[model samples]
Target: MPNLGKLIVHERMRRGIGPEPFADACGISRQTLYRIETGECEPSLPSLRKIARVLHVSPGKLLDLGA
Candidate 1:
């Protein structure tokens, strides 16, 4: 299975987005974003949906990476 953190990082970079703005867009603190991206924490479902919306992806795309 793919690491959720790495997938998040790859997709974020692929879209040319930086962490701060991305976190802001997701309504999360940069520290929370860092934790999620580093596998230190898993995002709450609502947070995951927010992240997917920001990234222009479906939540399943993110979830499937770890499935």
Candidate 2:
């Protein structure tokens, strides 16, 4: 499986988005975003949906789970 943290960080940076703004866009706290990005926590499905929406990606794409 792809590393979720790396994927998120990569996409975020690719879009020129900072952590704080990305977290706010996702309606999550910056600390939560940091934890998820650091592999310290797994985002819930709803959280994933929110993030995916903001990043213009599907949740499965964010999770990297094969169809």
Candidate 3:
């Protein structure tokens, strides 16, 4: 696998958004976002959409296997 979680985190960082603030904006806890970024859990479509909104990125970018 190409580490989807890292891609998410990397994109967030690239966009200058923090996990806590982004997750809060997404209505999810910071810990949960952290887990997603850490590859501890996979996010569902809705969650991915929320995260994409928070990160100011497209859902495809967030879920891109190539980062």
Candidate 4:
């Protein structure tokens, strides 16, 4: 399966957004964003939605689910 963490990093870099600022824009802590990006924890639905909105992507794009 494609790694969700890698995907998040890829998209974030592609958009030229740093982790701290991105997390701030998403209304989440930098540590939480780091954990999510490192695959240490799964994001809650609300968190995922916030991320997707800030990243201009669909939440499904951040999920692995064998896609």
Model 2: per-residue Cα lDDT over 19-62, one tens digit each: 99999999999999999998899899899899889988887887
Clashes of each: 0, 0, 0, 0
Clash list (residue pairs), candidate 4: none
For TM-score, the strongest prediction is: 2
Give the C-alpha lDDT of model 4: 0.84
User: What would the per-residue lDDT of candidate 1 be over residues 1-67, giving only the tens digit for each residue?
Assistant: 2477777888899999999999999999999999999999999999999999998888888877442
TM-scores for every predicted model: 0.90, 0.91, 0.80, 0.86
In model 4, the Cα lDDT at residue 6 comes to 80
TM-score rank order = 2, 1, 4, 3
Regions of model 2 farther than 4 Å from truth: none
- True-structure lDDT of candidate 3: 0.79
CA-lDDT, candidates in order? 0.88, 0.88, 0.79, 0.84
Expressed as tens digits, the lDDT of each residue in 1-67 for candidate 3 is 2577887778778888777777888888888888888888888889888877877778877666333
Q: Which stretches of candidate 3 lie over 4 Å from their true place?
A: 65-67
Model 1: residue 9 alpha-carbon error in angstroms: 0.8
Instruction: State in Å the error of residue 9, model 4.
Output: 0.8
